[model samples]
Target: MSERVADSTIKGFLYQFNKTILEIVNADDEDVITVEGVVEDVDVLSASGELEAIQCKYHETKEKFIPSLIFKPLLQMAEAYDRNPSARIKYTIFIYVPNEDHCQKDIDPSILNSALATTDQSLSKIVSRISGKFDKVEFLKNTRIVFGPSLDEIECSTKAALELLGIQGSDVDTLLYPNSIEKIAKLSSIKDETERQITKAKLYTYLSSATHTAISKWTLALRNRSEILKNIKQQLSSYFSQNSRDRYFYIDKNEIDDYEEKVVVFFGNYIKKYYSKPSHVTAPTFIINDNIEAIRDLEFRLYTKGIKANTGLVGNSFVVDHFFRDPMKKINRNHIEEREFDLRLLAMDSEQEAINHRKGDDLYLVCSNTPNNIELTDVNFYQVGISSFNELEYVIGIRNSHE
Candidate 1:
């Protein structure tokens, strides 16, 4: 038996981190804007050529306002103002901490007042105390700090944003952040349920330990703004496809061609041996099961090859269960044939017509990695294909182990 790892505290923090971003994007009096830069944690570019840069900090255990924590963001804001002389760019230090008392009473007012300070001496003294940097009252005037949105505020803003953006889903926890959604989409490409669960678990464990510090230190290096913006736009554009029918069990596109190659090699040889193939016959193309559209194409090819393949789940659930429990145990010469006969006798026919097409003496093909070997009496009525994902893993494992 294997020991399961404990979930980390940072998982909750990541959730809160995204919610904070959503809140900032749809802040009151601000139209939802395209994030324009990679310099700040959250950069909102308004239509009127104004910029609102927001730095998000989530410290749940900290009781007091940390001065040193605000320094880098403040310095960045000062530099940003210098870079863009014409644009009315503003900076906001958005803090989300568990200690609401100090934030609500002291930090909020102090930040606003310091930003509006008329005298250079007062602003410089405050800046020197916090960041060891001084001068530039004009830059300080455009900067502000405030406590981040509360849970309730986040909830309200999320609902409004979803509606405004025409997104429909009952999942409350799904943040409207582009990077988060992209991560989910990437994970969806893993076809095996067990692999997906294990991979996500490892990812969460890694994220919990390392992601927070990395995110805080992100501004140390800046990526190309256009490329970052393009990626973000592309991800946001794919929101409609986030609920794709086979998203959870789809094969990754990168593996699709290789899977087709393997299928051609494996099944083409089977066809040549079992059924006579003319010299004029070309290599049969395979459609991955994960592709709903390509599955139809596969059926057409199979039909042309004098083999009709049915992948529907009408009467498959029972057979699937039977296979998992007793794949090698043959109750009858034709298990599917016996079941169909019983169903017809009882007048309990399946609504789906796909399963009725194949009958007795025909080999049942299951796409799974189970029952390493199978045997049946007279004509050997069973056949199963190793899942493409597992086959790929096996091939890779063998090659690596050989070296």
Candidate 2:
């Protein structure tokens, strides 16, 4: 497993490093923004009318080297600039070696220079390849590469810059600050409630039209009793023939009726001991009744859990009317026969949380709300709610049994 550390620690280091570099470049006029997390090695962007990309690597040893690292990021930077011709970007690669003593003893300075020269050549080759294939207006130009000075030199330069800016050591210390444990504690507290709200929204949307289909199936099954019984008998016969005992004791119909009575009594006793009152009805009777109750009960449970019913509001209305309605209508058709049902619920909010209540799949965050106000029907329930995006604590309650 990879070593785990606080994200704030990483961010704090990057902030200080960026602060130090901006001072060294004397690019005070340029905007310095810390681009967090996404890119592999790149840390900060210094851009005025032109753009410069910087990659920071903090390594204790050679084993920490991330291979062929600069090639792709350089290509991406070049492409980013090409897309926006008006805003050109100049690329700079900074490899910070804080522990200078660990630097390979036999490695020649000239060879290091040659490797950088080769990387520069490779970057130009990449730009040429892209330009040849596509009609993009911007191609990389005026790109520069710099190897940061020794750690002592970097620290001295940074301290000098701090002094020049009239920043005290305490001020520098403040910039490297990490998030408090209390802040994390507060976030953890709300995380569960947020997850529950998200789950409720998801269940509401899924159960909206699909609940009708499940009810309709039960109703149809009751109406066509002969056909349904025939299918059930065939299924049960197949199951029992493979699993039941081969030897059969001869018994009269009266004895068979008596055995069934005792079996029912035993089942009732078992139910009374362990199961809830609603779950204790006769087996075949409960199967039909439970299907109807499940649909109604699910809606009630969702409401009680804090999800609102479909009120035909514009934001939440589209998903219920368009996406779920059609699929549910088809579910009533004759040929639809499946053991499991899969449904998607679009959250009432514009954000559109997607809550997927599958039999065994881990509940996960699939998508975030995008800027485009497009009507989304197939979104998971968790994506739409007010609380779901915060953190995934309540997802534990939304298991197969709960669904």
Candidate 3:
């Protein structure tokens, strides 16, 4: 039973995420949303300097609204009000109501007073925390209960909200949900409260201007390789470009057979597509994600194929200039991520070279089923999961007819 996933965490994350999106879309230009706010799960600061503090909850198992479920949250809000009595704060509970038949006035002033003012031993400590600090009447008057849709229903509502903001054609799943959720998760992770907040304008810009770039390392780990690959193909196929982008290939030498052979095939095809038969396409840089030995082995393999890759620890003096007629698509002498080889004498500083020749236009993290930790060189990139050498060829559109 424990192993069976109910996806409760995912539901909660998407619910909060959808709510944040809706809030940003509906908010005035000056209103800003503070993710994982001090007062509640979300806080909306308005142009008039008022705060709309919201606590969001998604409980699919619960049959209906229950005052006791909100015991701790209400107490926390009451305490917040007590601490800053002068602040204009409006408390709201954004919760998934089990059904419409649930109690209508579930959180009226009288109901809140009855629930919070209780002397029940179980809730005595909770009541004690905010006891006599905030005016019960004032708190109740400002507080309200908002029933939300079921977990399944939230997506449609969120999509409707997104549609209002001009998103169309693409699946909302690939574009906004993870992107916005990723943004919120990043913002909330910051300890500085002010820094964690985003204005509606800035957030709208982020959501609209940026394309799908969900290379979340853990999310990648969680998904089945096929599902992730499916999503990757779907997303990347829509905006496929091989120019000015860096292709990062991450292969755990332990996961596959004849890894070097397959990698060479990947390289050959990559070169064939972009550089060998040029049709206005700029040759994208390649970064082999491996330890020194593996990279050295790849260098040796490519060497046999008469392809000189700048990857190394393979004993050989190197140069930055394309003097030896090195393949244009081969790794640069000063590529930042790979480990330095002993004989591959690089005259340039790797980090500065990386910065100077930024692969910021396009990027990728193509990896095997279990590659090393894939750190995105840039925030925007596509991830392709390759199971076999054949699949690697297929993903890069180099699957030979004979194979």
Q: What root-mean-square deviation over C-alphas does model 2 reach? A: 22.6
Models 1 onward score TM values of: 0.36, 0.29, 0.62
**What pairs collide in candidate 1?**
none
Q: Per-model C-alpha lDDT, please? A: 0.37, 0.30, 0.59
lDDT of 1: 0.37
- Once superposed on the true structure, which residue ranges of model 3 sit more than 4 Å away at CA? 1-6, 100-132, 167-178, 213-235, 238-246, 249-311, 314-361, 365-403
**Number of the predicted model whose TM-score against the real structure is largest:** 3
TM-score of model number 2: 0.29
What is the number of backbone collisions in each predicted candidate, taken in the order shown?
0, 12, 1
Cα deviation in Å at residue 32, candidate 2? 5.4
Please give, for residues 1-403, the per-residue lDDT of candidate 1 as tens digits: 2221111233233434444345443554434332223445455555576767776565555676666555555655655566664567777777665655424222343453444342556455544443324336665667777776544454455446544543343222322332332233333344543332222233333333321111010111112222333332333333212222110011232333356555434443433432222221221112232343455454455556555343332452424222112112213443321111110110112222222322223222333221222222332121122234333222212122211
| Per-residue alpha-carbon lDDT of candidate 2 for residues 213-260, written as tens digits (9 for 90 to 100) | 111111111223233223323322332233111211111112122333
Per-residue error for 338 in candidate 3, Å, reads 22
Better of 1 and 3 by TM-score: 3
Taking the tens digit of each residue's C-alpha lDDT, what string does model 3 give over 295-372?
A: 566567777875556542224532334311223332444332222121121122221243223333544544423222
Q: Rank the candidates by TM-score, best first.
A: 3, 1, 2
RMSD of 1: 19.8
